[model samples]
Target: MFSVSIKASSIPMSEREPIQSSMQISRTTGQGGEACLLLTGSCTLSALGRRMGDLSDELASYASDPNLHWDLTKIDQMDDVGAVLLWRSWGGSRPEYLSIRPDQERLFSRLGKAPPLPSLPAREPLWIAVRIGGGAILLWEHLTSIVILAGQLLLDMKYLIAHPARIPWREISANLFRTGAQALGITALVGFLIGVVLSYLSSKQLQMFGADIFIINILGMSIIRELGPMLAAILVAGRSGSSMTAQLGVMRVNEELDALTVMGIPHSLRLVLPKVIGLGIAMPLVVMWTSAIALMGGMVVAELQLGLSYQFFLHNLPDAVPLANLWLGLSKGVVCGMIIALIACHFGLRIKSDTESLGIGTTNSVVTAITVVIIIDAIFAVIFSDVGIR
Candidate 1:
C-alpha cells in the first residue's frame, strides 16, 4: 500500500479567498493504487466565488489521469456551481468516483441546467406588384376626391359670381405677391440660362450649315412654346401651392374654418377663392416676364457667338415666333395656376387635426400640381404639334 502524503499550504485571507478555496485540491493515495481528490470551499454562489481559472486548472491536471478518482467525502459543502468543472474534468461523464450526499444533490439541482438555444426564423421575399397595385388604388381614391371637390366648386360658382365684391382682395394680393414677386428672381435666372444653352446648342448645328442667323428661331420657339410657361408653373406650384396647403391645413386643424362657418362667413370665399384668383392672375404675368428675359438672354448669345446683330435677332423673333406662341404659353400658365390652386385647397380642406396632416397636405399639393402641369403640357404639345411650329 502507498502511504498518503499531506502537503497543506495555508492561504492568506484576501478579497479572493473564497475563489482560491475552490481551487485548493487535496491529493490522497488510497487502497490498490487509487488516487482521489477532495473538492472543497466556495463556488459561484459564494460572496467571493471561484475564479474560472481555478476550474480550468483542475480540469487540465485531471485530463491525463485515466484512472483518477475524486472524493467529496470530506466536502462539508457542495454545489452545482462546480458541476460544470466536475463534468468537464471527468470527460463529460458524471464523476462516479465522487459520491454526492442527498443534501448536496438538492443544492446542485437548484443551480439549474443550461437550456437549449432557440432557432431563428427565415425571411420571405416582398411581392412588389401587390404593393404597387395597392398604391394605384390609393391614387384612384385621391383622384375621386378631387372630382367630388370640383363638383362642389361648380355648384358654388353661382354664389361666387353673385358676390364677387365679397372676395378677399387683401388675401389674394398677399398670395399673388408670394407666388409671383418672390419667384421672379429665380424664374428669370433659370429662363436666362436656358435661353443661353438653347442658343448655343442650336448655333453648334446651324453654324455647320451657315444657318447660325436662325439661332433666334430656335430660342424664340423653344422658350415661348415650352420652357417659359413650364418653368413658371413649376416654380409657383412648389412655392405657393405648398404654402397654401400648409396654411389652410393649419387653419383646419385649429377649427378656424369651422369657426368662420359658424360666424355666417363663407370658408371658400375667405380662403380657397382668394388663392385660386391670385394664382390665376399672377401666373400669366410671371410667364410673360420669364419669356422676355429668356429672349434677351438668347439675343446676347446670338450676338456674341453667332455673330448675329441684336436688331436682326429682335426683328426676326416676331416673324419666327408668332403672337400665338405667347398666347399658348399664357394659356398653359393660367391652366397650371388653377390646377395648383385647386389641388392645394383640396388637400388643405382634407387635412386632419395634426401637424403631420399639414405636412402631408403641403407635399401632396406640390406633387399633384406638378403632375397636372405636365399632363396639361403634354396635351398642349399634341395639339400644337400639327401646326408646323418647332
Candidate 2:
C-alpha cells in the first residue's frame, strides 16, 4: 500500500490566515454629510476567524455615531455569525440610518425578539453570621430533643421499676445478643492486634532504657483504663449504632412506626428503651473481655520480644493496674453505650419516609454516636485523671 503524506502548516493560529481576510469595514462621508459605515465581502464565521474581535470593535465604534448609515447590503455572503455581529453592534436594535437585504432583515428581526440572559444576584454582607446562627439553632434543637428523650426514659424507668411485669426484658435480651454477643469476635481480633503493636513498640523504648519490665505497667494501665473501652465503644458506634438507626429508618419507610403508634405502643417504651438498656448492660462485659484479650496479646508479644515470661506478666498485672481502673473503664463503657444508643435513636426517629432520609439519618447517627463517645471519653479522662492513673 502506498501512503499519501500531508504536511501540516507550521504557522501559529494567531499569526496565520488573518492576512487574507475578506470582510472589511470603512467610514465614508455620505452625500448628506452623514458618515456611512460600509461592510463588504464574505461576512461569515469561517471568513472572520481570528479577526472577529477587531471587526466587532470597529463595528461598535461606527455604531456609537447615531447619525451613521450602516450599509450591510455590500456584504457578498453573510451567515448567522455575521448577522449576530451586526445585530450586537447596533445595540440590539436597528440603527436609525441603515440599509439591509430581506434575508438579513429577518436575522435582525429574530435577534430583536430573543430574550435577554439571566444575571446572578448580589451576595449579602452578613452571610457568615447567618450561617453561624443557622448552625447554632440546629445544635440547640438536637440538644433539646435529646434532653426530652432522656427525661421520658427516666419517667418510663420509674414506671417499669414499680410494675416489673411490663419490663421489656425480651427486647433488651434480643438487643443484648445483637449489640454485644455478635460483636465479640471482631472486638477480640482488633484488641489482640492493638495489644501486639503496643507491646512491640513499647518493648523497644523500654529495652533502650534498660526498663523492659515496665512493659506490663504501660500495657496494663493504658489498655484497662482507657484504650479498651474507647476502642470497643467506637467499634460498636459504627457497627451496632448504624444498624439500629437503619433498622428504625427502614421501619419508618415501611410505616411500621406509624402502625406501632396507632396500636397504642410508644416508640420509647417498645423500641428505644430496650436498645439503651441492652447496650448499657452489655458494654461493661465487652470492655472487660476486650481488655483481657489485649492483655493476653501484649503478654505474648512481651515474652517473645523482651524475654519476659507470660506467667510473670500475668502475676504482676494487678499490682501494675489498680482494680479502680477496671471499674472506671467499665463505667465509661456504660455511659458511652447509652449515649451512642440515644444518639442513634434520636436520628432514627427523625427520619422521613424516604430512602434518602434513611441513608442520611443512619450516617448522621453513626457519626454523632462516635463523636459523642469520644467526647464522653475525654470528659471521663479529665474527671477521673487522679482516680485510675496510680
Candidate 3:
C-alpha cells in the first residue's frame, strides 16, 4: 500500500484537478520517436475564451502526424463546444492512436453518430434565382409591416390629437436633440467638403469654356435642390435610424418593451410617434443648415478659383435657384425624416430578443432606410421634375 501510494503520487500533475489548471498541450515522448500529444486542464467554453483559434491550429498541425497519439485522459472538464472543436480539428474522425476517459469517449461517440449536415446540390444553377426569390419575399414582408406601422402611426396621431395631454412631449424633445442636434457636426463637415470639391471641379471645367459665372448656377441649383436634402436624409438614416433601431432592440432584450405593453402603452403612440414628429420637424432645419454651409464652402472656393465675389454668388443664387426649389427640397426633407423614423421603429419593434437579432435588425434598418430614402428622392424627382426647374 505504501509503494502503490508513492507511485500514484509520482504521476503527472496534469492527471489531477483540471478545474484549478489552465488547459495546455504537451508531448508525452521525444520528437524523434512515437509521441503522444497530451491535453490537460479545463476544456469548457468558459475556459477557452479567445484561445480556441490558436489551439485549433496547433491541434490541426499535430493531427497531420498519423503516428501521434492524442491523449485526452488527463482532461477533467470539457463541454460540447470544445469537443466539437476537436472533432472538426481531427477532420471528423478520431486520431489513429487516442487515449481518452470513458466520459470523454462518449462525447466523441455521440458526435460521430450525429447526422451530418445536409449538403447543397453540386454547382446548382438556380442558386441566384433562389436568392432573388428569397429577397423578394423578404421585401414584401417588410413592406407589409411598414404599411401596418404607418397606419398605426396615423391612428396614434389621431389619438394624440384627441388627448393632447397624453402627447409625449418629453420624448419628442429628447429625440429632437438626439437625431438633430447631435448630427449637425458630421453633416456640416461632409456638406462643406462636398461643396469644396464641387466648386473646384466646376471651376476647372467652366474656365475652359469661358463660363466661370455659371458656377453659381451649378452650385446653387444642385446644392439647394438635390444634394442638401439627399445628404441630410442619408446621414440621418444611417445615424439616427440605426440608433432608434438599436434602442428599441435593447429595450426588447431587457424586456422593457414587454413591460410597456403590459401597462397598456402602445409603441406607436409613445415611442414611434415622438421620433417621427421630432425628426420631421428637425429635418428641414438640418437640410437648410447643410445647404447654407455647403454654399459658403462653394462661395469660398469660387472666390479663390474663379475670382468670383461672395456677394456676386449670393446675389445670383436667388435668380439661379427658384423659391419653388427650396420648398421642394424641404418637402422632401419632411417625407424622408418621417419615413426614416417609421422604418427604424418598424424594424426595431420586430427585433427578436437576442444580441444577434439586435445587430441584424439595426443593420437592416439602416440599409432599408437609406434605400427607401433614395427611392423617395427619385419619385419626388420624377413627379416634381418641372416644378423646381426653369
lDDT of each: 0.76, 0.88, 0.90
Superposition TM-score, candidate 2 onto the true structure: 0.69
What are the runs in model 3 whose C-alpha is more than 4 Å off?
1-133
RMSD of each: 11.8, 10.3, 7.5
TM-score of each: 0.65, 0.69, 0.73
Give the top-scoring candidate (lDDT): 3
The superposed Cα distance between candidate 2 and the true structure at residue 245, in angstroms, equals 0.9
- Location of the lowest summed lDDT over 10 successive residues in candidate 3: 2-11
Q: Which residue runs does candidate 1 get wrong by more than 4 Å? A: 1-134, 388-390
TM-score of 3: 0.73
Tens-digit per-residue lDDT, 142-186, candidate 3? 889899989988898888899999999999999999989999999
Q: What tens digits encode model 1's per-residue C-alpha lDDT throughout 1-390?
A: 111111112223354444444445677787767887656654434622536666667666775576667765455334465656555566655554655655555544453355546777654356587678879998998899888776766655667678777657798899889888888999899889888888877888999999886787788888998999998888888888888888888888889988999998776767777787788889999999998898888888888887899889888888898788888999889888878888999888889998887887788789988989999999999988766364
Assess the local accuracy of residue 6 in candidate 1 as a C-alpha lDDT between 0 and 100. 14
Record all residue pairs in model 2 with backbone atoms less than 3 Å apart, i.e. clashing: none
> In model 3, what lDDT does residue 22 have?
51
Give candidate 3's error at residue 312 in angstroms.
1.5
